[model samples]
Target: MEIIAPGDKFFHDIPEKIINDTRYMSYFKDCIGVIDGTHVDARIPVEEQAAYIGRYHSLTQNVIAACDFNMCFTFVSPGWEGSAHAVRIFKHAVMDPKYNFPAPPPVDAGYPLQRGYLRPYLGTRYHIPDFRRGHINAE
Candidate 1:
């Protein structure tokens, strides 16, 4: 835990990647890190395999992790069943004090908008190509 601490102290400064990139400097000036989840193969007893079998029909564990722009891991929450939804794991990480997830700044309104974090609305199509062409389709 000493090597991996999660708080503003460890991420107070804007990353160099964003600072150097004019396109993201102004927009993501305060951004700290990126969070995501993925499924990794897991080994378990035969009797417990069913619970781990996910969409890929293989035993796996869902892992939630976060990393700064420099590619350093800031937080990692692993061991969730592969069948578990990403939202379920993410909510637990945020609600559980033990995780000590860093809090982001506040936003006025939107889905998944918490005191310091925000996520894109689920089920909304967000193709960058479409956006680049100004053809965003309302969901």
Candidate 2:
């Protein structure tokens, strides 16, 4: 904890910046950042290989990570079994008081329901590339 400074200052500071950014405000208005799980190849004893082999049939270790739009990693949880589900990892991280993961959006908003967590309203323009294209000439 001393190395990471797991406190309000360390956790809330970046969220504030993300909340204020125009490009990220609307779609992920209530979100601090995005969390995702990745897989990295690993080697283990053949007897234990089944536990490490992932859905893709490759030996892997699951790594869950959180990052902001700037691509800065704020949190990382690694070394889970490859078979471990991402949602399970996420739930554990948020529920554990040690991490103090950011609060999720209001439940009524119906987040994480098939929209890749949060989706822009239908017909609404989103994505940084779209923003860049529309504002290419703007100062």
Candidate 3:
């Protein structure tokens, strides 16, 4: 994992894609990567199947992963039961020292906010197409 995994140096600079794209260059200059979770089918013993069953009633494992803007994987944490919430897995990855998750840059580093991730507001129309069509109902 060490060979392919991103080191501290990888998080210090803006991605070339973001720098070149006018739409994201200014907004995402301080962003390092994106993180999310997905469920993958898993085979387990009958006794352990219950823990692995997800909303679809099938055995699966919830895998948390992070990737840079270039879509290259920087970190992956798999084997969590599918029943586990994504936030739970994400919290574990961030708090656990073994994961070696890269720390966010300092607030004084020109970021407007002191946050590691940015999430769109709930129930908001965030797509460019939606804005263009004038469907501006955000509530």
Candidate 4:
């Protein structure tokens, strides 16, 4: 709410702002986001501890997450068991059909699949922050 302000438009476009953000581009090249998990130190409810308890570490219930270049939550896997491995958690939580966020739209005739990734002749843009200068470039 604080960042979105009182009445910011939903479809605000700011692609030109990041077209050549060298630092942000260099830091995040070939990476859409960095993913990780951290334990939140809270004892599970006594009744729920049976499932939440980790076999090895046995002390924490974790909040798994994926953070983008701006630290926005692209994905979050909360209430997960304390012992879930990164890959297992990522595979299930991020791509599970239950998750609300939509996956990337499938490519059609214009962009052929290459090396198991989509390559397009052109692309659309979005209103994203420019971290190169540590400020928002709205235009």
What C-alpha lDDT values do all the predictions have?
A: 0.76, 0.66, 0.76, 0.48
Model 3 scores what on Cα lDDT?
Answer: 0.76
lDDT of 1 by residue, 19-96 (tens): 999999997887777788888999989998888997779999999888878788888888999999888888888789
User: 135 in model 1: Cα distance from truth in Å?
Assistant: 14
Model 3 TM: 0.77
| Residue pairs that clash (backbone atoms under 3 angstroms), model 4 | none
lDDT of candidate 4 over 16-67, digit per residue (tens):
3244677566533334434456766557778767666665547667676654
Q: In candidate 3, which residue pairs clash? A: none
Model 3 C-alpha lDDT per residue in residues 34-103, reported as the tens digit of each score: 7777889999999889999998899999998888887888888899998999878877877798887665
Which candidate, 1 or 2, has the higher lDDT?
A: 1
RMSD of each: 4.7, 8.0, 5.1, 12.6
Question: Over 4 Å off in model 2, which ranges?
Answer: 1-24, 102-139
TM-score of model 4 (CA atoms): 0.49
TM-score of 2: 0.59
Of 1 and 4, the candidate ahead on lDDT is 1
Per-residue accuracy of model 2 over 1-139 as CA lDDT, tens digit each: 4222223433334465667888866655555566677889998888988888898899999998877655666678887889998877877876698875555444344334432246346655454446766644432
Which candidate's TM-score is highest?
3
